[model samples]
Target: MTDPWNPADPGVLRLPSGRLVRGRGLRRPLDGSAPTPSYALYLLGRQPPPVTWEFRWIRWPDFRLPADRAEARAALTEAWERAAGERVEIACGGGRGRTGTALACLAVLDGVPAEEAVDFVRSHYDRRAVETPWQKRYVRRF
Candidate 1:
């Protein structure tokens, strides 16, 4: 199955491997017209509100990294793999810092070089993604 999110949809980021994942901010109002993701990873300080779709919550504070690095990796890898067929999404409170970092990491899993993943996400997803220095470093080391 080659089901994928529409490239023109809000927050959609097409990875180098041709996998599509949407990145969004939970703090903002979700677009009612937008398609819902089959699976989503929420990088947030606390558990997100229950949604109709399946989701995993990673304890990632705003402007910070995941509390459990190993778990984050596993969850990110799951999201990346699922993106091959499912409509995967990566999200956070503001969607630029934590969300961007996760997207960059996903890029790495999708065959993008770790060093260039941040740039790739910024160019295609959000101009101000991967907000902090540590976030960029994390992507580089991912």
Candidate 2:
């Protein structure tokens, strides 16, 4: 199904099940015209700013790895489920490493093989995604 928000942004990733979840850089300005997400997952080492949308923050360091695996998994799973019917977005500082890692995990949850999730994310979302080796390894483990 086409996303009601039509989040045609730079980091949107459309999963195999047609779930549309956008991945973006938190540093970038949110487009006022863009549709607000019903749920937003923020991957950051620091606390995220307060927002009107239902949100979750995963203690993920930029260019590094997620601080908590179990929590990250739960959050990503929740994000995956929400993406099926709601406007769900995953974002981080630069929106490449942590964001892409989360997106890859969501792809894995959506039935993409864990081994191929990172490549799938890169090919469909961003070529420079999943920046570090550990991040790619994390996707494989996801």
Candidate 3:
């Protein structure tokens, strides 16, 4: 049987360097009701089979990166480095605040002005992204 999620949907982003990543909300269901898979499983590749690209997750909540900035930096760095070889995704519960924050950080590593990352995401991803005040603050810091 064919799946309906369509992994190649617009929610996915491909940077200039061919890195593909998708932002998602953890609270949301995978097939509409099932539990989310393991972070490693989600990032290593798509579900089922045919692993198209590698992935990794950054477990940011509504408005916070990992308490350990070191871990957060490491994860982001690894994602940045792996961008050259495979797709890297950073997701959260709303795909807006947290995901957008992570994407903005990626943009910073990609040379986007730290000041403009939030606007960049607003223009490209969703105007509603970076919704929370803390989310905006996080973008500036990144």
**For all the candidates, what are their Cα RMSDs to the real structure?**
1.1, 1.9, 7.0
Per-residue lDDT of 132 in model 1: 98
TM-score leaderboard ranking = 1, 2, 3
For candidate 1, the 10 contiguous residues with the lowest summed lDDT are: 1-10
After the best TM-score superposition of candidate 2, give how far the Cα of residue 7 lies from its true spot, in angstroms: 6.1
Give the alpha carbon lDDT tens digit for every residue of 1-142 in model 3.
Answer: 1122223665555554445555665455457553222222122112323323444444444555555556677787776666555434556666777677777777788878889988877776767777777767766887
Clashes of 1: 0
Q: Which stretches of candidate 1 lie over 4 Å from their true place?
A: none
Residue lDDT tens for model 2, 25-131:
88997888777788999999999999998999999878888798999899999999888888898999888889988999999999999999999999988998899
By lDDT, the better pick of 1 and 2 is 1
Per-candidate TM equals 0.96, 0.94, 0.68
**Who wins the lDDT comparison?**
1
Can you write out model 1's per-residue Cα lDDT over 1-142, one digit (the tens) per residue? 5468999988999997789999999988777887888999999998899999999999999998899999999999999999999999899999899999999999999889998999999999999999999999999998
lDDT of each: 0.93, 0.88, 0.59
User: Quick one: RMSD of model 2?
Assistant: 1.9
